[model samples]
Target chain A: MSVVPDSSTDASGVGADPRTGPAPGPSRAARLATRGIPLLVLLVLLASAPLFAAPFTANTLSRILIFALFAVSLDLLVGITGLPSLGHAAYFGVGAYTAGLVSIHWTSAAPVPVLLAAAVGALAAVATGWLAVRSGGVYFLMLTLAIGELVHQLAQSLSSVTGGSNGLFGIPSVRIGGEPLTLAGYVYWYVLAVAVLGFLGLWLVARSPFGATLRGIRDNEPRMRSLGYSPFRYKYLAFVVAGGFAGLAGGLFAALVRIVNPSDAGFTTSALILLAVVLGGAGTLWGPVLGAAVVVLVRDTFGPQLDGHGPLLLGVVFVVAVYVLPRGFAGLAGLVPGRRRSTGGTA
Target chain B: MAGWFDANLVSILNGFAIGSLLFILAVGLSIVFGMMDVLNLAHGAFFLVGSYLAVSFVAGVSWGGFLAALAVAALFGLLAGGVLSGMTEPLARRPILDQALLTLGISLIVAEVLSIIYGNNVRSVPGPPGLDGSVQVAGSTYPTYRLMLIAVGLLLALVVWLVVERTSIGALVRASVADREMVSAMGIDNRKVKFAVLGIGSMLAAVAGVLGAPVYGARPGLDKTILILALVVVVIGGLGSVRGALIGALVIGQVESLGRALLPELASFILFGTLALVLIIRPRGLFAGKVAHS
Candidate 1:
């Protein structure tokens, strides 16, 4: 909690001078003001989106919420923990499969499937992370990719359970108090409520001591180890937490689409989610949500017009973003308030 | 017993052919990452283009046009390498993730453009005319084209090994791989060596792509599949080791073929299983190479 403000100020590059304020307390309050105002306005806008948005736009926003939550979970590993997992969609897929299976076999009851999906996702993460976290850097990336591929293969081969290549369809609608969420507005509200809770939960974790320890691990694993902290343990716990949230997002996706396929677990999906996190300014939790919106909008707006060339537009967006907006939307936010002397510095 | 022997022999031959293709793909990736510290995910795009170009040449002209396709692909590789260098050198101080994302974007663009031009259907290319007939071996008839693949693989292995281990350029590359700053401090132009290696590596991938189209077909997303498989080969064989890639490719090729024969439903899992086991047993890979830890 204590480190969050300092890191934010460092990232912003505005509060570099120590003599900017009369006291430390005032500086902290100022930091919160600069960040919090934008967050509040964004929250209000997201919450009220269904009021004025069209049905298609509302549905797109709902899809964005699911992907945003997933991307944020990936950010926990990539940005905060310095573990860039390419197999993140494995857990997401597991959650989606669990939820889809539940709706098909056991019940259409919403909470039960979501909770079960979370549990399955966390367990899968632990199982995979145990071996994966043992290696660092490129090896870690490779291991995660292999594990993700294995899961994808499983999804395809387990035909009876997963419905094979065609995927599990006709998943019952998520019901709230015996009422199905049929309309786009209703689905949006439901997804928004879930997303809010999910975001707040993750925000609390990010602002906690655990989050600070993760940042420390990311910056210097050896130093953390020298200070008597087990880096492996922290990484494992973080992976589990990230996987849990990814699973929740997966459940939302399954409900949103009413189907789950092996493609959901594919490496391309994982890459896109990672791209979203990077585009959003990795460490900032909320930035990924905005990143997801940009990616989804890019895909949606040009996808039909370009047909098969949609990924080409996205590729252009990625390359341009890397060169032009290196710090992503969060960095852009810092520039808007003119806190930093120059926006050219590395984030 | 004779029947079993014939089947096993054929499987082994097929695996080597597949493995030979993988070696060409993986070596480029391994060398680029090992020497330059850049994981060029776009390496796959080079291969994708080669495959598509080969398909076009073979269909429009003749099988003899395969060589022309390879030449064009190599030229394209050089141009692409120059473009990549231009894009990446400006951001030389950026993190590996940023560089990787940039390369990935290039790859995605290539793949999409190819799909747009070729229209996403899987297209196969026939081998050159002379390599069409089947050869009888161990009581089984096998495509002579596959044997030619093995021969190509062996020749490439020998050529690469001789060049890397026996040539002046190879020594420079080795020295650069061991200590880049030290090599540069000695007044050696390491940047040129890096570019040369990148260009050569990309060319190798293109050649593999031309050869691979006959067996695997040219298709959208072929880049992603081949990229993952090649990465796995590099990891299992140990990064930057030419010999390791050869051995690793052979092993994966066998696993893929045998798994397809035995457990068709679990062919991909067999490869993943090997990867997991190898990583657990030797995190640096089965044959640790000159590449440094990240």
Candidate 2:
């Protein structure tokens, strides 16, 4: 359970579980993150003109951070919960469209829209996950894909409410007290805050008895059931949690973009989220954020140029990541200490 | 009233005609997936190649030359089957997702490479002269080409069913899917068995591509659509059962065709609605399935 347990190797040089370890003290993840300081420092140097990287680049980075949170949501499901959702775009789109629609009609109380987006995402997740988590691997994947597409098709057909194919646009942005926030600043802060809180929250979840039970379900659902634990309940709980987190990411997205296109809920979007999780290493807390960064850079830079050929690249990455570096970027540290624990089990 | 009846009845005929091709495309997918747990995403790529080959052949020679194009496409499929077999045999032992991801990669590469060479445009393969005209059925005029397509498709389906149900090879596939390692231990060259299974499956997909291209038209995203449809067929029919595939295909075909004719607005939801309900009720599939989800 929980990928060989978090007790084996601690970067902090203190044997501590990532979940229960004291928060105020030097954390184990922070200890692990420090191992990549040299790499981060070098990359920071290359990106020296943080101010001059153009509002465009900064805006793009902001979007990537949001996507990273999206991927983290997926990681919550796939990496931790042991459910590889092919329809994560459902929650993401739900959150995005909710924020867009609410702000368009009401345009009041910035927190309300964000709260509503997460609620909508979680509600949809509860509905879809009830059915989805019941199935095993492949069907679970296909059903999710079908559910995601079903929502997308509905969005297309119900244009009157959904704004149809054109999507909701020209929506108002979030304001703290009647002053508009800087586009990059607002996006950066929101993404940063979500990523941090999300990381800590999930870390806590992974440590709690419930998290341990989820890991048990992931590793051996039948055995856990035999032990008198209803694995289905555990799976349903994880699925709902993942959906809420995914919804949170989607809300931030609507706030940033001010538009919710059909593509937001499309299969391509789901596939991209999968790619980010695979790149970031699924179970690790901060891995998806880093992955979202890589994917964002790739899309912002190469996505336009590739067009139809973009699937080719994403497909290749999916295969290669599964084959070559299954552990993804975060697990790169674990590899050094001969720690082969690569983010949860694959079923 | 009679005139209106005739008008709409012809639409059902057209729907059945279109559905025949869908069945052809989905059949091979159902068999291979049913027998071997491999989800060949590249099946549609084979179809695309077949279509492109047929278009070229039809452009240069007589419409009968389309057969020659099919033969070439089949050969290409065999080569692809063998190569993938050699590369992924070890990997397929684990989970279906790994195989899905691998095939997804291969197909992406095939699509990208082929697009670069052939370019992305809708291309057609002309029908043979004898089968290219109009025909009257039930006091309604239907395109002769479509009527002929329906007949030819039925014949292909019959031939496929006969081979799978009445051959030693079919037995081997049925046995292999139940447990490959057991079949391997039984001293049957399971590799040879699988090689043949994939070759036939791939050829089946390719032939459907060559024949259906003229009707549906070939494009960049055609393969993806075909893949999804095939999966739907397999799931409905139950995975690994040929009869299930056919039943599923026919159900979907009838759904799309009749749904469009009767209720155009809700047409998109018809098949999906069926799928959801069917799955909830009959989680195993239409036909009694040999393998259960792991």
Candidate 3:
């Protein structure tokens, strides 16, 4: 609650200083900002997709980019906040359904539905977060899971609105500023911009004072309480914020696909996000983006071709990550001679 | 008035029948969770495995072979538990995130392997010959197999209660769960205890699956559904507590069965409603059981 940013309080012991803030000499924030330049450059490359990659490849890239936004939001909770939520798909579904419903009935500009989607996502988070923040440790994990499952069940059952087991189809393309954004190349550019902005925003949040407080709560809740900070408040804020981003991503997805299905809220979506976080290294800003790309690519390459072996391969990869690279893909930095040390195992 | 009482009693019995089976399955889940910290997301896989294996076992043999099938299912649980232990052992050192991910991966693998072996189709195991018939109960002709299922569920629940509450191995397991380091310090290798407990837990799940197949039916996605229900049971029953498991099972089972019978449309929603209400009141679980650590 204090406005003064306490630079010294790494007291919440979850991980090292992920927040690149007002430190001495050139400021770590500036350095991180500079480091982010390459990511932007990559984003630029992604945006000009049809020029470099094939249309199908470009569409794949767009899908990955959209998922990357979702994954990055997940990383806020899973990696940075040290709350490895297994059921974030609740928010994702909320956002998608919001947009889906909006698009189905009333013809509106894309931004309206997107905003509504984010709003629904935030609302869902607030509702669920109120209950979810009570329990810490494993119990917290289970509670979030239940909430996510509950939402999924609701969405599946409310067929009149959600279209039930059979999802809404033939949804018109997103009408943006009185123009239809139907081109895949245009969508890819939009997705890339959104993902880049999402990452940047989260990265900034991770460096902010609120981020430091979350770290404290994650590492040692009792100690945080001793320091006069309520862990529940901090957790609730972070949960809602994370949910908001998930909604943002979900809205973007609904617009692009023009449909929202039950899978949007299922365990598989949760698993996918979890895998991405674990792969990219949960707390790192760029980790989920990288992990999402890898997961999407692997599935795109192998899943359809492998016929019944896709899940087996993915499962094997997941097991290998758990045992071998607990820190995720970004965890490889630890193995390098002079690279940054990790906060914990990749998972 | 008599007819109304009879109708309500029938619904309640039907609910109890379902609840008892859930108790059987969830008891194993509760015990394993209580004794060992492993979530065993793959626990439901063992149940599915039990159902399929029972189908194979029944195809060749007579009623005497049911005992053999049950034993085989138990043995499978033991082997599966061993594999699960091996996979989750490293992450088991740390809490929470590791256990969750490792078990989740194991579950995925089990599901994939099952699909590879059995294909993505619903398959049924025929009830034992004599029990295949229906019996008149409370003016409703319930399947004889369902009645046997209730009997088997209760019988297994009793045996589990006896072994866990009264047996030496149960005591050792409980003690280890209380303090693993202390138990190990006392020269009672907690690993052995964990392995044994996991084995029994898995056996319980398998037996539940076998018995449940004729009553609840079998499908490709049964593992996933069973896993979610078992989790609900664990949360309701309290982590690692046998008594908690029984209550949780009965409550969830009744909700599921009655929901199916009465509210045909909202059957799935009913199970979740009970879970949500319980979770709101008691986040640690309605019954925390005897384990010191969550």
TM-score of chain A of each: 0.87, 0.82, 0.87
Task: Give the alpha-carbon lDDT of every model.
Answer: 0.80, 0.71, 0.74
lDDT of 2 by residue, A153-251 (tens): 667767877887898787787766766665675555655565556655666666566776775666666788899998778888888877877887888
DockQ for every model, please.
0.49, 0.33, 0.47
| lDDT, candidate 2, at B257 | 76
Clashing pairs in 1: none
| Residue-wise C-alpha lDDT for candidate 1, range B74-110, written one tens digit per residue | 8988778767876788666666777778988889899
lDDT (10s digit) by residue, model 1, range A1-347: 24354544342322222223233334656867887799789889988888999989899999999999999888888877778888899999999999988988888675777778878999999888887887767777767877787788789888988988899898999888888889898888888888778887777666667887777677667888999999989989999999999998888888888999997988777878887987887777777888988888877787889874778887888899889887788778773233221111111
Minimum summed lDDT over a 10-residue window in model 2 chain B is located at: B285-294
- Model 1 reproduces a share of the real contacts of 0.57
Q: Which of the predicted structures, 1 or 2, would earn the higher DockQ when compared with the native?
A: 1
**True lDDT of residue A218, candidate 1:** 75
